[model samples]
Target: MALVHLKNAGITDPTKIDESKTKAVRLASEKVGKDLYRQIYDITFIEKNGPRIEVITSSEASAQECSMSGVDVFVVSRRLGGP
Candidate 1:
């Protein structure tokens, strides 16, 4: 599971999600070396002026990995939560 908190308004433009923003949505590993990783999933905008922002995660497997595996993938921006 993974969670991300943004200090500012995140890019909502589907066409503007360049390399930098796209790189954040992934998992890291160290089995072979430090910080080794793979792109497990990708994010895309389906509609404009959505009610709420969403982050979608996917896993390639036949069965669920854990009971609470995908329960914590969320984003919290400072704009919604005052300091």
Candidate 2:
């Protein structure tokens, strides 16, 4: 048996960045972390399965899980148009 049994996974085509991205990795990580939390609550994505399954998990909880496993999960997000 294998971990992360991904199958038929797909992602949208890459798009060009139209806005300036932040250079701070920490800020990007923070934004990504929050966005992931939103995605979990919003169920933004569905995993491909006989019966489609909504992907839901807490970003904080995931971080803790990774820590316990001696791994790290970084949710980095780059953005545009900011003060």
Candidate 3:
């Protein structure tokens, strides 16, 4: 996503910095990057403190949302994995 970040920042009419490296003011006004490695913590949290809770992601839950309404609620976030 470094490329995405740079592409976003380069659009802001950069003077000193490379235009291709920065995004526009509107797009670059705020930046949020994910570390993409939080599934371990999420799974651990659920396993250590289970509340009959089945932590799942959007993609996972999407396949079973309607069927899982009575059981699991899809709270999609940065992390989700394990049994």
Candidate that would win on TM-score:
1
Name the candidate, 1 or 2, with the larger TM-score value.
Answer: 1
Off by over 4 Å in 1: 1-11, 24-60, 63-73, 78-83
lDDT of 3 by residue, 1-83 (tens): 22223235442111223333322121111112232111111111122222222223211112223222222223334444754
Q: Best lDDT goes to which candidate?
A: 1
- Candidate order by TM-score, highest to lowest? 1, 2, 3
Ranking by lDDT: 1, 2, 3
lDDT (10s digit) by residue, model 2, range 12-62: 111221113312222222224632321122122222322222232333224
List per-prediction Cα lDDT, in the order shown: 0.35, 0.25, 0.24
Clashing residue pairs in candidate 3 are: 8-23, 9-22, 9-23, 10-22, 10-23, 11-22, 11-23, 11-24, 12-23, 12-24
| lDDT, residue 50, model 2 | 21
TM-score of candidate 3 relative to the true fold: 0.15
lDDT of 2 at 35: 26
Model 1, position 5: C-alpha lDDT score:
24
Q: TM-score for every candidate vs. truth?
A: 0.23, 0.18, 0.15
